[model samples]
Target: MVSLRKVPGAHQHPNLPGKVKVEEDVNSKAVPVDQETMPTIIQTVKEDLGELKKFYNITLSPTRFQKVEHYLEKKLEELSNITFGKLNQAGQVDYALLNNYLKSSLQRLRSDKVKDDEVLKLVGSFAFIIIELFEARQRIQKLDFQEVAALFTRADNSARDLKQAISSGIFRGKIERTIAYRTAYKLEELSSVLRDWHNFYLGYEPLYSWWVSQPYATFQENLSILIACIQTDLVGFDDSVKDPIIGEPIGRDGILADLDFEKIAYSPEELIHIGEMEYQWCEVEAKKASCEMGYGSDWRKALEHVKNMYVGPGQQIYGIHDLAIEATNYVKDHDLVTVPEIAETWRMLMISPERQKANPFFLGGNTMQVSYPTDKMSHEDKLMSMRGNSIPLSRSTVFHELIPGHHLQFHMIKRHRPYRRIFDTPFWMEGWALYWEFILWDKGFPGTPENRIGMLFWRMHRCARIIFSIKFHLGEMTPQECIDFLVDKVGHERATATGEVRRSFNGDYSPLYQAGYMLGALQLYALRAEVLQSGQMTEKEFHDKVLHENEMPIEVLRALVRNFPIDPDFRPSWKFYEKN
Candidate 1:
């Protein structure tokens, strides 16, 4: 489901010239380390380190890298205080100092000449290490919902800092700028929504307090700075630009100029109104549950009850779940021919609650376990309390997250040979899940009227998000307007809609949700056509190829595919893979 876009022109990494020669001479052979040879403990440690290294190399910006280093220093210091059998005082100090030196080395590279592409490549190589570190930190932290929420706030800040740094140093061309700008605007809407959400959180002071108590102070502080930088840059853009669809400045008049607007069955205003109502309905349901459960009830339990109430005995909800299961079964039935290694590796990856706490992005909601390939006895015992609840907007989300989504993606990455780093792109990761939702629906799995209604509702939600994101970023709407849009158009309740709007404002990156999903779907459709024309592979083959690559930006996927060697005798057909 990764969206593919060409970079337009080849651009070399800034530091490539100096390092290429040296790197070429250092080590070129793919290390062939046997997974079975190493002791279990050592192997686990090695894998963890590898994942951490990968993440650091790809995504670490100088500002964020420094933050991570500081965090590590603090953590090591904390460990020093705890009583442990593994190491003496001197050993602990040595460990801390070693980490200090490693961080310092990474810091020194901040100024080292390197091309953006090269940096991306380096990140890919060491992404596994970053993943491991992230997972490990979560496991050790045992973070709850409140703590996870705080981390998201911090993540937003880190993201801002990275974006600002990149923007200052690099001049993206007009096309790239336009794309980035539009995307940013969408994110702004999402942030506004999130802010509303924060306001709602404030209503429950105890929960809010618990969230603030997490180790996110630094993240929040840094985020504030990052937001300022973004705002400054955003203010410079001209807002009265002419619309492409209508040859006039984008405004109420411009929207009226489009012929399609009149032809469409639903008006924009109508859609927004629907969204608002749905949101309110959801809120009413939540409030009723809250009162029943008591004011200080466990948020997790409360959320589960709410989800179940929403799901009810509807075909739409149940059908999507069944479709998701079918998708998982298809993969299992074929042994995932295109990516068998990934299928094999699924049995080894464990989903720990601590890890979920550490990474807000991976938090499991309303599910006893969100995502785990191997259901060991331990996992089985820890049954998730949130199963068979309300249908999340993303249909593929259930399959991808719980059944085949995360688990399948992770296994593919682990087993990939000459592994192209695909896990580096969050956009594609989420997009894949969303894409699967529709894929199942299109396959006729969710055929009931209720399921259809649910699907339409979900679509409406996404559309509202897109519109909200665009209007807010373009300065066409206020935060309140964004809230109104969600509540009115998307069928969200007033309170819930308001919360979503606030979330958009405060979080600032929610637009990526729609952008990623839309982009992924577009690219997948295009790729299917390309493969058919070439007559080189079956649909199943292409699908396997796509999944095998795991989750990567569309552009990166295209590059890999363009360079991929396919059998000349292979005849492309959708039927290669089972439809159902």
Candidate 2:
């Protein structure tokens, strides 16, 4: 889920990444965070993520003109005051984060050229509404269906009013049209969310008794009408359902460049050939590794042996925590990269059932969420989870998700130019973590042939992700075909393979995300070969510097790390992958 669970890649960093998070999240000076509100805060922010769904929704309309300018300014000034107020170092960081984020948001909102005002309005509204809803959900009597219906009724009326506003011809031009469209989109999205919650709560007798009464069209029905309006002739947007807000099909050259292969000078067809070759070569290596481990080239048996070591009698959680600690110690001993003091306090939590589908592996940054099955899972689910994540598999992931990976990235992002956290892509997020797998492989991290095979298994999976994602987006491969490719070519457990595909298309991930793991890592590997391998910088220096730079496209990252001449208006022209 590091990148794949993205939209849902499903992480809601309790600390998120940047300026606004600092202001809105850190609730108190003495306490730093209000315990009672923290869970609600985290969950609400995730729900607020809905505000980011439709890019057109960010555009504003003249009809929406309000006195919000003064309010935003006042709120920003108050946040700035918090930053200057006296507090402990931790509290100071939070205050500063909030102050900076609000300042940035305020500046953007004031820009009439950029409709960030509308963006903030909706985003802010979502933030407030989520908190209010969180509190309401807690107080509502479980059996009181009317109370739940009241929440829907409030949302429905907003929809009805907005529908009439658009139909009334208040929206005339592009800007006004965009504003109306976005408002409609948001209302529909929120309505859909409420409908899901209602269905979830309807199972209980208390709620069920109230549900049997009279009802009109559901919120979903109202949302459907609004959707038709915005998506159809009532109003239109540059973005379509196929073209997601953050995603655009970049075609072959773009894919190559993104993977740091702009200079490879190979045709897209050539790249496909190379990928197939790599896939085949890995198969040979996998069998060879199994043979060396006395499994007689049975790759499955070899992997199973390692898995059974961790899966214990009568169902235990395995040694995931111990393994992470061990990996942490290993990194500290090797000085692979700086694991700051902040990482010391980072906690490892089990993945929740609700999240496991999107994040079948793990999600980590400040906190490492292990993907092992909980006590609530069925035996079959537990078995598949165990087999898929066995010891060697987890070895790569633990290091990938914790130290030298997300946790370190998160720690550094907070310490560095926190504002830079705004620019996010899988290139840096998942790529950095994936790069370590390559780095560790080269340094002989997998001491035994069996270990090598396990590592190779993951390596193959990464490669396969690239090939399948490319093929799928190009209209050459279907999702089911992609799934078959993983299970067949990579030897992935069937259930686990399905989860990987699900993560790729989970409605929030970029089309290229599945491919990003290997491609991004390859780019970093190529960059290191250019500078670090040439003794321009030691491994420790290179890794540490990369982290402090925060996340961005690998091309831009290369420009920064290499000290390449970057004009004010910089563009990526570098091809770091020509060699490979």
Candidate 3:
């Protein structure tokens, strides 16, 4: 059955988020039940944490933090008791994933607490007062309405006073100002939490309402005003410039930790080098395409020409539909992978002007959303939209969104070992879609030189993402620098480049999300070569096997596909790609 699910700590706009899995009729004798790989303890811990998180909803609640930490520690001890060597291959994979998940969760909780403390230092005791109220309410303690009302008054006055200090140049340094801005956002969340708690008892308990209603309203208003003040005065961002790219650079250590969590065998520098190497290959191929297009060696000119090849106004959707059909037929004819008829059936929708700010391209699953000019857009914006979603560019990725990309990926995952969905990584999800682009390009799917350029352009963009995103997280690249890199290096439209950088650093995505596209594709590409060379599986079987295995780190997937022995203490040691 279809159901709404929350990915724990999923805070970003994913590459292809929100695809509803169509239920499979497993009652049919033809449908075989997939083997269960997830260990019982892993499932139990996942379920327990999901429940605990629902009740402990407050972000900065000390009680919630303590309980989660203790719970994780207990779970770790229980997991350690399992016999790792006795488990089957899939069971071993699950064990490793569970161990990593438990450790990573603990690390994240501790890290979040450190950040919360830093933000609290800037925000003051007022935030803690609001947190205390939520905690007390959750405890079902008898309300001391007058005392609680007095606390709200103190919080409101203190919040207003803090705003005045910030206005008077209290936080002058850039780092201090950044912290203040973060505190402002944290206070905004606190304001919402307080409002929820306030509404819970607002009119339900007459005594509480009489004593606390006005104070609660006053405190909430003061919190909003403070948030606005921090945004406008400290951060210099108002409504007109609402989406300023103020990303939190996780630094080198953070990047290293993230790499470990993703089970990536390479170091941050090595990954960037891989990106650069791949980018250089794209550049060489792009020059060849440019030459064929009569643009000499200057690929930028070739890119501009390709961009201007947009279909007539109001005809973008039909072009997309035709491309989807073409791509689906080509894959089926080639026997690349099985495409269920249902995967080909997708409804079309137009992206809103606002969403186009972050995702200025196509997104697909059960529904394919097209990005093109609308009547509400300005002339310049409309032109940019059309240019960005040109026929050539769209052709390169039509299959990436539909058919062998997101649509097929989502369809197969549901019918397979769906319980492993919790272990999903962008490296597999986005990487699988991106890998098709590589294979199709190798098979000469990009027919014309302009089409080749289109494919190369996205390949170059993916490589650039790896560079800029990794560098940005490692504190080597600023958001503005990243935008400039895309524009100057990858031949991106200035507006499109800006949107990309904004999306990358807006804390909506994990640090390595952008890098996942190309790097992930490379991982899969290497695996395919290994599998084929060893005669382990034919081409079609290799492709189909991946989808049925559901989502995991590519490294983990590699171990599964290759039938390598996995241990409970498994560390990522597979260097899938070697530098040429």
Q: Which candidate gets the maximum TM-score versus the true structure?
A: 3
How accurate locally is residue 439 in candidate 3, as Cα lDDT from 0 to 100? 98
**Per-residue lDDT of candidate 1, residues 290-366 (tens digit):** 45566432323444433343332223434445545666676566543343443523221224534422221122222
Clashing pairs in 3: 12-508
Q: Ten consecutive residues with minimal summed lDDT in candidate 1?
A: 17-26
Query: Model 2, which residues run further than 4 Å from truth?
Result: 1-190, 193-274, 298-301, 313-318, 578-580
| Candidate 3 stretches greater than 4 Å from native | 1-39, 139-141, 174-178, 236-242
Error of model 3, residue 153, in angstroms: 0.5
The local lDDT score (0 to 100) that residue 260 gets in candidate 2 is: 37
TM-scores for candidates 1 onward, in order? 0.39, 0.60, 0.90
Prediction 2 TM-score vs. true = 0.60
Candidate 3 RMSD computed on C-alpha atoms after optimal superposition onto the true structure? 9.0
Best by lDDT: 3
Better by TM-score, candidate 2 or 1: 2
lDDT at 49 for candidate 3? 79
Q: How high is the CA lDDT of each candidate model?
A: 0.41, 0.59, 0.82
**Clashes by residue pair, model 2:** 5-9, 5-10, 6-9, 19-101, 20-101, 22-98, 23-98, 263-575
Please write out the lDDT profile of model 2 over residues 1-580, one tens digit for every residue. Answer: 0110123232132212111111122222333333323223223323333333221122232212222344335544444433233444323333333343344345434544244355335333232332233223333412234543554465556556655665565544544444445555555555555454455555554544464222324545655665665544444534434322211233554455433322233445655665676677777878888888889878877777766555653333346676677777877899878887757677767777667765677677777777777778889888777777777777778778887777778888888755446545676789898899888888888888867877888888888987887876565776668779988888777777877887786446865677668767878998888886678788889888788766656766676667654332234465555534
Error of 2 at 578 (Å): 4.6
